[model samples]
Target: MISEQFDLSNRLGRGDRTALGIWFWELDRVLLALILSLLAIGLLAVAAASPATARRLSSADVSLPELYFFYRQFAWAVIAFVTMLVISMFPKNMVRRMALIGFAAMVVAMLFTIILGSEINGAKRWINLGFMSFQASEFLKPFYAVAIAWVVSWKLKDKSLPVYPIIFAITGFLAMILMLQPDLGQTILLSGICFAVIMVSGVKFWKLAALFGMGIGGLVTAYFTYSVAATRIDAFLFGTDGITHDKLALSTLSAGGLFGVGPGLGERKYSLPEAHTDYIFSVIGEEFGLLACAAIIIIYFAIIIRVALRLFEEKDYFTILAVTGLVTQFCGQAMINIAVNLGMFPSKGMTLPFISYGGSSLWSISITSGLILALTRRNPFMHKQGQNRRYNR
Candidate 1:
């Protein structure tokens, strides 16, 4: 019975005519393993942070179960993985169409959020449905990347099109809404994704420089105008009490030394706000050590490198651009989250991908993983047959 099951599961034929059959045969297994490993580590990290988080919340009469966040995060992980699998089954044209529709819906939702969303940490970024609060920006990112890549690919195919200007206009509109939400982090993050797509699409050097200058100028304006940005900058550069989180994160990381204090035995996590969400990396450091942190970083880098390597030989412009944008956004968010934990950058309140205890972040990142998987999949037999045909010719 086990042999029958294994045979049924492991084999795929060119004659097979099903979506699952194609995906099962073509999906990049190494990339999937790396992502699943990160999700597993995230669960462990959240488990470590749960007691402290629960205690802190319960003290304020928030009344959560001791492992509430961990359990919820686990549930989110399941949903995220399922979403990724379903999305990966979609064909390229369908993915693009879906992204178009999803982007429009998210834009409308974001506008509504700006008007009626719940305020958290002095930022209005979530729309509270009766069941849960959803962050539209989290869901918007992958679709936004797809939409931008689609537009840029069109310009690549037709030189007469005024593509860069259209990109700029859309970016400006989106940036305006994001800044109105006062989410400077996401505004910058999405801008980086767009810039990466533009860069890969081969825009003029002067135009690229102008975009970079605009980004810098936007940062300056944000630092001066928003107290949140200003406070983080002041804390990071001038040294202020506002850096309690940063200081705690660094000290805890340092305290862990080479190895960790052991899982669920972390002390400093109790004092750090958002330990389960934004600073879970530090919790991992404190419990599992710098070696584990390094391993995590390497896995993230490996995934990016693997994706880029797969796309190196790809001839499809849309596939290359869409995957590039998605991977850039994925690795970019991971870098920002880790940088803030290490005190290398100002606090951004961005959750570590896969590892952070947030439903929206987990699900969004899973969608990104699925997109990468679908775009990178190449049929082994087709590749072999192409090589054979070339040799014969």
Candidate 2:
């Protein structure tokens, strides 16, 4: 969106440059507030879920503090905030380039993961750096969105599916690695983002249909071709696998109705698996009640819809597709997680994006939202009185 005025440098000035040489904008304030709001929700959800988890993992002699997970998450939140601020200050081109670099790096990391990564929990999804594991799939979601947005946005005189194969190859390669992780969840999420970008590009329907066919074929391969995948899907369908965690989550949601049992008074936390990670929404339902859960869902929808509504005000294709990909994937995954919670879908290990309590995912998603803000920040003209009135957002 900022590019409309890029050539007219004399017409616009980068907002007060800092020692870091980064600029600022009015949109930054609004976007930052939204990001922080998600963090606040994360903190609240973690507070409700962590104590129970900690007790399970702790010894009776060593009683854990209520703030154990909360403090660690707070620290990560602080780190993520700084990371977000630094990214937000960069120029639009710089933002795009940085995301491209991240995408490229994750591509290479995924390759290495296939060759030499450890397989844990039956999914080879992590690269061990001695001290920690890096989930390349998680880190790549935002980057891939930006990279694809940057790639597809060029108004090509040639209407052909120019260089799209390369994008698909890279995307497919990443999906292959996640499938190796046996992580159908991430693979599906990645595909959803890819689909959103492709659809928004106004590409021919035949191309979309072909890709859709290929994607469904790939999922079939992932399920039947890979033993781990086949096992999970089979378990999901027959409800007969050694794995039986999702039912607990559904039960938890059923327990929490209109008003929730009130926070911290949850009985389900003790029995529900991943109470703080993939299934935190279930806890919200169980303790806070369905009304509270609905309120959380409303927050997520508001964020996604609010972002999508403003894309037309963007001056460039990159911003539109990038925001579209990011928001679409986010809301899509959130819906699936909610669906699973409601027993409308099979158990899928999908985390509730910003609200999940894992280490890397929260940090990565915060940075991703920061990138979206950086890319989608409205130009000064877009926010002017007349422009806002005209856009009708």
**Best candidate, lDDT:** 1
Query: TM-scores of all models?
Result: 0.95, 0.86
Q: Write the residue-wise lDDT of candidate 2 on 205-309 in tens digits.
A: 999999899889987877778776676567667887676667778888878678878889889878876787778888888887888777778778778767866
In model 2, residue pairs whose N, Cα or C atoms come closer than 3 Å (at least 3 residues apart or on different chains), thus clashing, are 257-290, 260-288, 260-289
Give residue 174's lDDT in candidate 1 (0 to 100): 88
Which model scores highest in TM-score? 1
Give one clash count per candidate, in the order shown.
0, 3
lDDT of 2 at 249: 80
Error of 1 at 7 (Å): 8.0
lDDT of 1 by residue, 1-393 (tens): 999987677567655557777777788888899999999999999999998898888856468887999988888899999998888888788899988999999999999989999998788999877666799999899999999889888876788988778878988898899888889899989999999999988878998999999999999999898888999999999788756788788887767888999988889888988889888999999999999999999999999999988898789999999998899889999999999889898889898899999888999899888888888888877878988999999
lDDT of 2 at 167: 70
**What clash pairs does model 1 have?**
none
> Model 2 off-target regions past 4 Å?
1-24, 28-31, 59-66, 115-118, 129-132, 155-161, 381-393
Predictions in order: lDDT: 0.89, 0.76
